[model samples]
Target: MNTSIPLAASDAAATSPTTLIYWFRNDLRLDDNPGLLKACQKANNLLLVYCHDVAAWQMTRWEVPRTSRHRQQFLASTLADLAMQLKSHDSRLLEVEGPPAELLPALARAIGATTIYCEEIAAPEEQEEVAALRAAGLTVETVWQSSLLDPTDLPFALDDLPDVFTSFRTTVERHHVLPPPPLARPQKIPALPPAYAALVEKWGATKGAISSGFADAEPIEHQASNSVTYRTGGRSSFPYFLPLFSGGASAASEHLHQYFDRKLAHTYKLTRNGITGVDYSTKFSPWLASGAMSARQSYAVLKEFEAAHGANDSTYWIWFELLWRDYFRLLHLKYGPQLYRAQGLTSLPQPSHDARAFDAWCQARTGESFVDAGMAELSITGYVSNRLRQVVASYLIHDMGCDWRAGAAWFEAQLIDYDVYSNQGNWLYIAGRGTDPRNGRRFNIQKQAHDYDPDGAYRRLWSAQ
Candidate 1:
């Protein structure tokens, strides 16, 4: 029952001229990706492939769409940027629409691929994809490159990981664990074989060969609207800080540099809780979640800034948050599918589900102004502050008493930067079903508003229109 997949021996032992398929999953960027580097090293000819999950466009059990237009558009932009980068390096991204389990094996066979290289995602659905590919006799090479700290450097084994964040952080810090410096971007990626490229184009062109419905789907633009829209630059509303916030590796790196250049990390702890505007927090989560930004890359830059600017609590806290990210990733290794259960990592009876209450929470008709404002922002822009997220999540589970998974699923559907590990872990934690020491976390909505939005500015800003 061991689900932690290792790179196939055949793939690892691969030498000499060979055709390889580099399947892009969560790790979308070219920089600091060990899997992509491995692919380049092994590939005489590479075929870059991205399969859009057709299931992502459909509704979940909660009745809301699994992925919103904003997230889908962001992904499209990311793919387009990746495609441009590949072309510049004598390669191209094959964008198709279908389950990776089905599309990948067929595509690999069609192109004479012997191996596939991809990021190792521990979640059930992602894991299943790799298993299926291997079952099809393709050697799949999976890399663990998502966390700031590598699993090998952890103070304990995955099964022995600390149950709480504080203990895990303290132990790692005590052991002086540091993430390796970010890898430099590859100068040039291996080119796809001309014949393979032609085959990819041909398969993509075929209607029934791939997920035909969204194969040629286009990236959507941010339109200005009163309800849900991407236009965020204006008074009386929290501006989205658009044009600069496009999804891609370049954009992620640029924003990281700009944040440090402007000396914004110094005040991150102070303003991270603010509900409105772009400057309130680092806003790196979206890129980081989407794999446009590497946790190690961001950590390396943070250390460089601290070396020049001197260390402070804020700088240290940024790294602390990253440690939390790593902690959840490790927790996945420990608990596996238990993290997704109704009573996650616990033996408590399942939490009750209420459809009507859940609908009200999702619709932002929860009668709590702060919760409504946060939900509205998430609905409209596909973004919300960390503080707002906790507030809304607490309100949903504690005040509304809806199933935590329902709320987690809603966030999954709407968030532009959704990461499965963090999304599920956080939801389970708040619901008292995961690794929370106190069992469950409850927030006082009135007090949260009074503290974070004293003048009711955030509530007024989002509630209007």
Candidate 2:
């Protein structure tokens, strides 16, 4: 599901409205959401549900919490904003906790829902969730909405997708493929059935009320036991503590428009790699990752800015980065579960794990200033510059001699903008397990520090804590 669907009112599903559920996964915004739009058209009365997967709160094999407080706080804010928008549209959101397989089916049976609609996520775990729902006797229809370019518009079949990103990018540009224009926010959201609303209320759950106990400060695994104080000095590159940077559609929209109004995209390529600033990079990943913003929405605005102000190499580079995101996603569709293999698509041997070194790296005590600074920023701020992400990731894999999967798991647990496709793809690329012709990427930390942080400002910025 790597394409945009133009949902039409005259479609077969819209012939007559039926009782259905709309499960909000990664695509959270009401704008340009083909899946949700279809649900709005096809549903007589829809139950808009978002499930907080229990596994996200539990510990991983690395003995770290599956998610950090920073990620949860941003998520809470995103869900809160989404609920508000839904409310203004005469609809509401139901926040439930538990696996979608268990919670959704019970709700459907309880409310007599005929179908469930959601955006298609091509990753293995997300695919499994959809399968589990069907196994439990529910019909789920997923629309592809994440990728910028539609799969049908691609010049090559997915199986023939280039193994290298440069080739993929060049081919896409040569063909002039473009994203479907972003759709407007839905004017109306169908009201919830009285019976369905009563049933959930009787169960002691209402809009904005959790159906399960998922508090923001739930006890974590090792980080809690060690009395680790998760705090930042408010100097983060992408600080979520501030209201302007808060999660959800409103902030995302404000940030998006202001970014262009300030004409930041003109210098995006030059400043995107800066280590210590708020506006150095686009900082859209947090919203983009949380589904609070859509990639198409961002691109449409970029094009609008270009139309008014004109385009340049910097503006072109912005789209280049977007293509990289789409490449990771299309890779999932082409290779499927192979991308999750320990050796990835290559025949490389298993990566060895060094628990002690890995733990030191996670705690920001790796004895390497550059890597430690980056790791510290990630742990406390849940956000790091893209350059530092590559640097710290390379250090953990090639220098610390740890399993790449452990590093990926730690990132999944900590990073607020963690996308399954990008996290896994980047780790595999750095570990030499993926389709890299060079096999692996090993950064010279000293040179990187000199090139990116010549005055040691970034290192000192994170050192005091």
Global CA lDDT of candidate 1, please? 0.80
184-222, model 1: which lDDT tens digit per residue? 767668877667756666655332432233221112234
Q: In model 1, which runs have C-alpha deviations exceeding 4 angstroms? A: 1-16, 205-241
- Output the TM-score of candidate 2: 0.92
Off by over 4 Å in 2: 1-17, 202-231
Residues 353-405, candidate 2: write the lDDT tens digits: 89999999888999999998998888777889999989998999999899998
Q: How does model 1 score by TM-score? A: 0.91
lDDT of each: 0.80, 0.85
Summed backbone clashes in each candidate are 3, 0
Cand. 2 Cα-lDDT: 0.85
Q: TM-score of each candidate?
A: 0.91, 0.92
* Model 1 / residue 418 / CA error / Å: 0.6
Error of 1 at 225 (Å): 10
